[model samples]
Target chain A: MLSIKNLHASVEGTPILKGINLEVKAGEVHAIMGPNGSGKSTLASVLAGREEYEVTEGEVSFKSKDLLDLSPEDRAREGVFLAFQYPVEIPGVSSTNFLRTAVNQVREYRGLEPLDAVKFLSLMKEKMKLVEIDQKLLSRSLNEGFSGGEKKRNEIFQMAMLEPTLSILDETDSGLDIDALRIVSNGVNQLKSDNNATIVVTHYQRLLDYIVPDFVHVLYNGKIVKSGTKELAMELEEKGYDWIKEEADKATV
Target chain B: MTTITKDNITDSLLATVHPNGNSEAAQVIRENGFPTTKHEEYKFTNITKRIESKIQSFQQAKPLGLTQQDVSKAMIKDLDADVVVFNNGQFSAELSSLGEGYAVTNVTNSEAPFSIKDLYDDSYLALNKASFEKGVFIQVPKNKVLDKPVLLLNLVKANDGQLITPKLWIDCAENTEAVFIEQTVSQDEQAYLLNGSVEIKTASNSHIHYYRVQNQNNEALEVNNLLTDIHRDSTFTSFVLSLEGDMIRNNVTLNLLDSGCEGNMYGLYLLGGKTHVDNHTNVDHTKPHSESNELYKGVLADTSRGVFNGKIFVREDAQKTNAFQQNNNILLSDEATINTKPQLEIWADDVKCSHGCTTGQLDEEALFYLQARGIDKKQGKALLLYAFAGDVLEHLKIEAFKEYCIDLVQKKLGTNF
Candidate 1:
């Protein structure tokens, strides 16, 4: 579903992602785990087309099309979703209205009819159950004054509504408690299908227990230094990242 | 630019003064002359030049009449309101219809004792008091709740540089509820000057909603003043919408006469071209336990200018008063300008009062966030602007008017998002 070849990225002329390569087919869930400043978030940001990050070299292909050539909005319309670590607090814009606008825009791009108010509300109610979100939260301003868990759950609610083909969960488990982690992961697991792919970026192995990953890649110094299965996450959590950094230092030498 | 001095303008104003106008206010005008930019209130909205030229031609022209077609064309279709029309600054008996339970008469002819000295002020109010020939007195009797709004339409029909000064006095009695909507209309590209004033006294236990819409022609300049007195336990709410004009200045004042009164004043101004809008509001909390909330938002494009000055005064006797004021502005172009000032004066010891003002461009992060959600730049901008104005627009209780204002803002911003 997605392919990245020698992905070299930078922000403000400072190189971040030096050389990275990854590939994932449809229905596969990949977890990118690393310590602080290991370029895990940068990879997600670059994939979501954040304009601040300059792709100095390399290419990303999604379904045989140049993904980097499309605008962020076009990338979104093309079924690329990034659940932000910090969802913006847009005042005066209700969550329901924002989600409706996003859904209609994506549907319009795919030559589908727009949902009316009644249909949209009904669809929202059905999908809202996936994240266990209260109906009252949907009518309030988007993410304004929302708790950290509510913000993350709202992102999952949006993912369920948009039904993107490739979803990037950037630090989705950073601020979640055990209960919220279960709910967010449950929503993600339910939305997974054979026609879609998932990339979970996290610093802990706690979230892996809820939504188990098929492939685990340890990103160190802007490169994927290790690739394994679910055991890799547990191994890193038990032993910590010092040994991995030592190995990376030896490899650089 | 015609060469006309301040003395010449003052002489012209004195020559055509109304016969039944307030002599004390006329004397004050004769002494002070027209307010210049030196006056603190008129510093940014300096209209001495326009006033000098426009008032010259206005004093020389004859009073122009309006046809029913002109009134019909300017009326909002299907508004089901108690319509009151003023043509050329005079009450149009042929155009107005006072429905059941709505009473309106000429204040100049009313036997009820009235005094203009209590409402007099500097140049604009003084001028309005001196030249207001069509003073309307609209009263909603005790314990009455009107189902329909009282629509006051002031139309200026390209009357060869006529000066239209219309006056309105509204009294919502005790335990009554009413709505008043005042709108100004004129022909396209017609130069006219309007100095209008409205005085409203909301009695105790009454609820009043007043809306003032200034959708003037591009060649028109208006200076409007609204003075309201809110009694104990009464709620007085007002919304001012300024769409387009050459220059418009609004002066709004609210006096909380007794305890437990509430005052809400909101404004939205979307201006472009070389147009200008200035709003000055003052809320005097003279009684204990009164509350006042104000929010004024403006979006200026092209080379237009906007000025806002809101003052909240808590008197020494008014303990435990709560007042909040905020003025926010967005300048869409570099050439557009805004001057915002929020003033709070608290003489009481146990009062809570705060005032804040902000002037800047749109938030880049918010815009990019919207665009990242599949919305384009234009649509994203319109959405952000709509949200910015939502602080005031959300207070519009009337459903149709709220939608109308949303449509107007969307059209002005060039997007329907």
Candidate 2:
């Protein structure tokens, strides 16, 4: 469903992701994990077409389309979603209004009819229950004065509404409590299907406990050093990334 | 035929003064002449130059055949209010409807409540006093709460080099509540100058809300002076919506005369093209335990220019006064400019006063966030600008008028509200 071949990315002349090669088929989840400054979030930002990160050398293909060539909005319209770690607080726009515009634009891009207000409201109500979010929260300004948990849940609510083909969750569990993490994971699990994919980027293996991944790749110094199964995550939780760092350094030398 | 030059502009205007005009006001205008850019008050606004270049003569134009249909077309749709129409600053009795609980009369026929002596320093005020031939005096009796708002629809249809002076005096008696909406519309595209003034007096325990909407043609030059004297325990609130004009200057002053008075001034200007709009607001707290708040926002596109000068004064006897002022602007184009200044002078020790001004472009991160949600760049920008304007739009009390203003803003920004 998605492919990244030698994707080299940088920000302000400093290389962050160097020669990253990844491929994922349908119905599978990939987890990119490493210590701090391992270029985990940078990879997610590059995939989402953030203008700050310049893709210096590589091509990213999603569903046989050149993803890097598209603008940020075009990327979202083409079924690529990025759940921001720090969602912006826009004080005047209501959450419902924002979602309506997003949904209609995405639908138009997919050659589908736009949903009317009644239809959109019904869809919102159904998704609201999946994320355990209240209607009052959606009526207020988008993410304005929202709590940490509410913001994360709203992101999931948006994800459920858009139903993107490839979902990238960047540090979603960083600010979540135990209860919020459980609820968020439940929403992501329910939204998963045989034709969709998700990439979970995090530093801790605790998030993988709720939404397990099929492949776990350890990233260090802008390169994926090791690829393993779920057991590697448990092992890394027991021992820190020190052993991995030493091994990677020796291999480089 | 007299050719009016910049040096003889004042003489040409005074030659056509009304028979009831004040001699002292004429003397003041003769002495001060027209303010130049060197003057402190008119430093940024070059209204004299605009007037000199556009208006060749100060003679009144021949009256265009305006009727009730023209007034109705310019009115806000579905607005439930008492309507009064004016054509080129003259009251059109055939086009107006006098509702219950209020009396409207010509200012010259009635006992005028406004004096030019209080505002002797301004040549524009003197010009208005010396040349205004037609003015309205509206009185609301004591203890009467008006059921509907009063809409003063002033329509302008003038030839080149013509001048229109619209004057109004509104007196709300003690313990009364009322709302007034003053809207200006140009019937033609002729270049003209509108020198207008409004004097409002809210007695003890009265509450008044005044809304002024300026949506004139591109060739219209306007200078509006609005002064309100708020008495003890009264509340005076004003909203200025400047949407379109070639050169527009609004001078709004509020005097909190007694204790327990409250005053609020809110303004929003969305301008494009070569339009220029200047808002100069002053709030004076004269007695103890009074409060005043002022907020003005502007969005300049194209090569448009905007100026906001907000001044708040707390006198020595006005102890425990609370005054706050803020001015914000957004420049959409490279050539668009905004000069904002917030001046606060407080002589009282026990007072809470703060003033600030900010001018910048729209937030790039906020725009990107909206774009990331699948909205295009243009729609994202429009949404952000509308939200930026929400700070002042939220203060609108009338729902229909609010929606009307929102529609205008949406149309101006080319997006949905």
Candidate 3:
């Protein structure tokens, strides 16, 4: 469902991602684990089309469409979603309002009619139960004054609302507690299907226990040095990323 | 610009009809000689240049009849409120529906006296007093809560250098609650001058919410002076939203005359083109244990210029006074300018007083956050601007007015978010 070829990106002329490639098929879940500054978040931001990060040389194709040529909003309309590591607090705009605008925009791009208030509210109520979010929180401003766990859960809630085909969870388990991690991961697992793809980017292996992945890749210095199954995540967690770094250094030499 | 001498202006008004109780104001105008830029109060907003450069005589403009098309532009549809329409500065009884608890009367026929004694010396107030031909006096009785708002629609037709001085005096009796909305709009792009004055006297324990909206055409010039005297235990909340005008100046003086009074002044100005809007607000904490809060924000695009000067005074006898003032601005273009000043004078030792001012652009991070969420750039910018003005709009108690303001702000930004 998605392909990245020799992805080279930078921010302010400082190279971050260099010589990276990855592929994900439909109905499959992929886990990209790395330490800090290993380009895990950068990959998420580049896929989300954050203008600050310039892709100097790369080719990203989503569903056989050239994704690099599209803008962030266009990418989003084309079923590309990035659950942010740190969600933005948009004051004065309620969560429900934001979700409705996003959902309608995506639907409009897909040549579908916009959902009216009654239908939209029902969809929102059904999705809120997945993340165990309070109805009152949806009425408040989006992420404004929300707790860390609440923000993570709200991200999952938005993901559920949009139902993107290629979802990238970038460090989604960073600020969440154990209970919130279970709930958020449970929501992601519930939304998984045969037609959609998921990419779980994380620094720890704790979140993988809830939402198990089909493949595990260790990203070190912007490139995936080792690819394995679910046991690789546990191996990295037990032995740490230092051995992965040494192995990457040896490969470079 | 031709210098307008006091004798020239006074003779012109006296030639028409010397109304009673205006002689003292005329004398003050003669003494002040129409505030020049040298005057501290008239530094940023030079009314002298504004009036002399555009208009010649301060006579009442020829009253024009309104058509079906004009009514649509004049009134807010779907607004559940009592609407009062004024045509060319004259109250149109046929176009008005003022419900109970509201006694609307023309100033000339109303036996009750109409006067503004404290502001007799101020140039704008004195000018309105000297030459105002048509005015209205709206009175709300004691212990009554108005069922709906009273919307005073002040519409100005195409001008032949007309000087419209619409004076309004609102007396909200003790323990009363009411919302008064004054909307000033021009029909065509006529270079007319609207010199307006409103004096509201709120009795003890009364609650009054006043909204002043200036959506005049680009060629119109206006100077609106609002003086509100808030009595003991009364709460006076005011929001002034300025949309467009060539030059608009608002002078708001809120006097917390007695103890336990609370006053709030909130304003938002969305300016573009060469439009200039100046808001000068003064809050006087006269009695002890009174509180006052003031915040005025502005968004200046193109070459628009915005000026905000907020002053809070805690008098010597006013102990335990709490006063806060803030003015924030966002300049979209490099040429867009904003001059903000916050002044606080506390003669009382036991008082809590603070003031702050800032001028900057919109948050780039916030804009990107919206744009990344499938909202286009134009809609993203509008969302950010809406968030910037959210706090002020949130304070509006009336939902219809709030929606109207949101629409105006969106239209000003050239986007509908």
Candidate 4:
């Protein structure tokens, strides 16, 4: 349940996302594939309400509410989750504590009482299985001294805990080994429901193999130049974004 | 090398001398005299300003804020601790109780064989003796493992007048185990000075856990020192959390007297406004096979300042010694400053010793990531600060106290997160 029209955003007065538009319905997974500096991340960041970027034009709506007007925490409360390409290593904040705060914040927004500690721990145990994360890891600081794979897996753990209505994962599979990719993908797959949506933002097409997207859009120069089925991801991966770049040049000519 | 030799720190310290120019403690300061900057220990933090700006009013004012009930209420949950309450610098029997297998008695002004006979430095130690109100002498008998942590709650409510000296001595006997928790707090905004000393002696095979919490009033200033001696195979853990007050200085020295002795120290200091905190720690590896590890972290905001100088000295005969020390700090405002030094002096070739110190701002990249995840700047910084302080907080062995420390730090940061 998301809609964007003529989206124009910038950072420090420099144009990034210009005249871009996209729409996605509930329960649909959309993959935005773009080469470097194509404004894919800016779109994701603007949607999550990062303050650095100025929304010079266009408006976004989530379930018909003005998205741009909401604060970051408000967006988080409204079930907008972002999986950072590089997860932050929050020293001294145990994984369990971070997730608990996030889950309770989300739950509070929905008018739900915070989960009791016992109930919370059990829920964590159940979720940890989805990502193959160890209990010992949960006991330590969030992502501190964790391997790249562990950090990626921890992101899925958080997504599981918050159970957001929409999750925008930016390169969740960038550093994962095949096994970790399978585990992370499986986690995202299990957390998906018919009432929510997903946006997979990545530099590679391998992640789409496990949780196949409903629409594969090739993004170039702040605009989605082409839209196709899952085969499009395979085609882009096989020949690379050069084909998309060439096609954009041909259009300009 | 003489006792309390005067140095350059005292010359530069002459400016801030107040109107009266003295307290019973200041008289001691003038007599015992200020140690120069060349004094190895006082090198990093220039305490001259503290000496010259000394307010005579602090030493005479009666302690303010807390009553006996307030202290008893704050004792550790379910702990059968020997409760000693010090209101300002004076010990209150009406507010104290000694636990089983232990004896807690006030070391009154008239007490015999008082170390008052062999004084250390000026008013810092002597003021406690000249007009000292109360002190505790704790003795845990041989081989007894007391089941609870001793509670020493030093409350300085508020006062207009002078200084409060809280004094303590603890002797945990051979093969005995004990835990001690001390809290220094003030509720009123009255300006005062606190000079405190806690001396501990651990016998062979004994285990001691010491926790110190400082949450004094915003107008208060304090200088506290602790000397701990560990015999063979003894273990000592000391953690200090400094949160409030205008100025705070802490000195902790651990002397490992026998082989197999161990020392673990972790401290967290959070300062804002014009508050200042200086911590000096010395871990001495005297006997062979002794080990010591120390980590102290601070978060400074506004114009507040922090100083950390930790020294690990391994004597020539102390072979196989393992000593590690780290001091890290974060400054929230550009005006905030941290002067940190971690020093290692190892004479034994077989020893493993390393010390590191870093002063920095919070990671911008990490902050951006949190913001991109829909967390605002304030919440993101709070998360990182908590994470920074979390490194030391993790060493807390008690769950409730650990949570208490985290909450206290968060409140000090003045953020809802």
Per-residue alpha-carbon lDDT of candidate 2 for residues B1-417, written as tens digits (9 for 90 to 100): 358776787677777666677777778778888888987888899998898888876775545588778887988977888887777887777788878978988765124566522432688877787777667889999999998888998888776438888888899999999889999888778888889888899899999999999877988899999888999999999999988889999998899999999999999999999999999888989999999988899899989999998888899999999999889898998999998888788899999998888888988888877777788888888888888886797888888888888888877776321
In TM-score terms, which candidate is top? Answer: 2
Question: In candidate 3, what are the lDDT values of residues B110-133, reduced to their tens digit?
Answer: 232455445326766777766666
Q: After superposition, how far is residue B289 of candidate 3 from its true place, in Å?
A: 3.3
Model 3 accuracy (lDDT, Cα): 0.84
Model 4, runs deviating above 4 Å: A11-14, A118-157, A173-194, A205-212, A229-240, B1-32, B35-59, B62-79, B108-123, B126-134, B157-160, B364-383, B394-407, B410-417
lDDT (Cα, 0-100) at B205 in candidate 2: 98
Model 3 lDDT per residue over A1-253, tens place: 8999999999999999997889999999999999899999999999989989999998999999999999888888888888989898887888888788888888898899999999999999999999999999889999999999999999999989988999999999997889999999999999999999999999889989998999999888888889999999999989998998998899899
Error of 4 at B362 (Å): 3.3
Off by over 4 Å in 1: A225-235, A243-253, B1-16, B19-21, B50-56, B60-70, B107-120, B202-204, B230-233, B272-274, B300-304, B330-336, B358-361, B410-417
Question: Of the native A-B interface contacts, what share survives in model 1?
Answer: 0.51
Q: Can you give the DockQ of every candidate in the order shown?
A: 0.49, 0.68, 0.51, 0.42
Question: What tens-digit string does per-residue lDDT give for candidate 4 at A110-182?
Answer: 8999898999999999999999999999899779999999999988888888778889998888978999999
Angstrom error of the Cα, residue B292, model 3: value is 2.6
Ranking by TM-score: 2, 3, 1, 4
What are the lDDT scores of the predictions, listed in order? 0.84, 0.88, 0.84, 0.78
TM match of model 1 to true structure:
0.89
Instruction: Give Cα distance to truth, residue A156, candidate 1, Å.
Output: 1.2
Error of 1 at B186 (Å): 3.0
Count of clashes, each model: 0, 0, 0, 16
- Deviation of model 1 at B252, angstroms: 0.9
lDDT of model 4 at residue A113? 97
Candidate topping lDDT: 2
